[model samples]
Target: MLIHGHEVPGAIDEETRCSHYHKENDRIAIKFHCCGKYYPCYKCHVEFGCGKKEVWPKAKFDEKAILCGSCGNELSVNQYFQSGYECPNCKAEFNPGCGLHRELYFET
Candidate 1:
């Protein structure tokens, strides 16, 4: 397990495997559970850690940073240039560079 940026030697319960990635040539091959076959297609080069479940570039984005309320954690305009306004944080999901943060509260 990772503790304070260090890994402790112990047993783990979770594991993950990608039907993609080439270790010999240092490349990743794409594999989807559809059509019963692994196929190659378009992919995004976003920073590692973003969730991607869609097709191609539409799959990757700053999903984690979207919830960051701290300044300098905002999305960049260049990313906006590629894909339009689509905030993944609060319901104010259409203002790419909005200066306002959402005040919505949920207790129900």
Candidate 2:
């Protein structure tokens, strides 16, 4: 799918194959602020990410910083939160447990 005129990769189809937090049908891939790369969740970042995690600047939360791995929609952190953690485009349900790791992507 096209996001901001660029290609955003699709979600990992085999959820169990990866150590991320996505459930069997979750389509949201977190655009980790530290590396500016998308992953299924913080655990995926921890296992596959590069270097140490860097906090997202408070000012960047409004940018299209999160990704809908299903349809390649780039949404802001606020939009993601407002979405009830679901993808607005494809209506894919996100893992509810994701809330436990909010600090990985956003500042408390």
Candidate 3:
């Protein structure tokens, strides 16, 4: 997909996924994930490594994503960290229990 450079800023609600996806063997086969972003779209642990303040450092996030630090033990796409979207993840509010810590910040 050719994303116009001008369109980059207009992408208010867009997700960048593997252009080609298939399942082989016992693992969900996927092409080499091209580095782009890890913006958490939902409570599904989707995160963007944009280095935003919402991005959890390597050690903070964990495998067992139980309760998030912002939304408490809730399971909803809206509860997950997002970019630009008004963040509901607050201290002691929701806890995204996962191996990767989340922060709502962007590296400039």
lDDT (CA) per prediction = 0.23, 0.65, 0.24
Q: Report backbone clashes per prediction.
A: 3, 0, 42
Worst 10 residues of 3 by lDDT: 23-32
What lDDT score is found at residue 19 in candidate 3?
23
Q: Which residue segments of model 1 deviate by more than 4 Å?
A: 1-72, 88-91, 95-108
**What's the true lDDT of residue 24 in model 1?**
25
Q: What's each prediction's TM-score?
A: 0.17, 0.74, 0.16
Q: What is the C-alpha RMSD, rounded to one decimal, of candidate 2?
A: 3.9
Of 2 and 3, which scores higher on lDDT?
A: 2
- Give candidate 2's TM-score: 0.74
lDDT of 2 by residue, 1-108 (tens): 334444334434532213444456555666777777766666677767765677566777787776665566778887888888777877867666777777777887
Model 3: lDDT equals 0.24
- Name the top lDDT candidate: 2
Which tens-of-lDDT digit does each residue in 1-108 have in candidate 1?
232222212212111112232122211112221211122112221212123333323233322122111111233323433324443333223332222211111011
lDDT winner, 1 or 3: 3
The per-residue C-alpha lDDT of model 3 at residue 77 equals 32
Regions more than 4 Å wrong, model 3? 1-19, 25-56, 63-108
Give the alpha carbon lDDT tens digit for every residue of 58-86 in model 3: 44333222222123232223233331222
Best by TM-score: 2
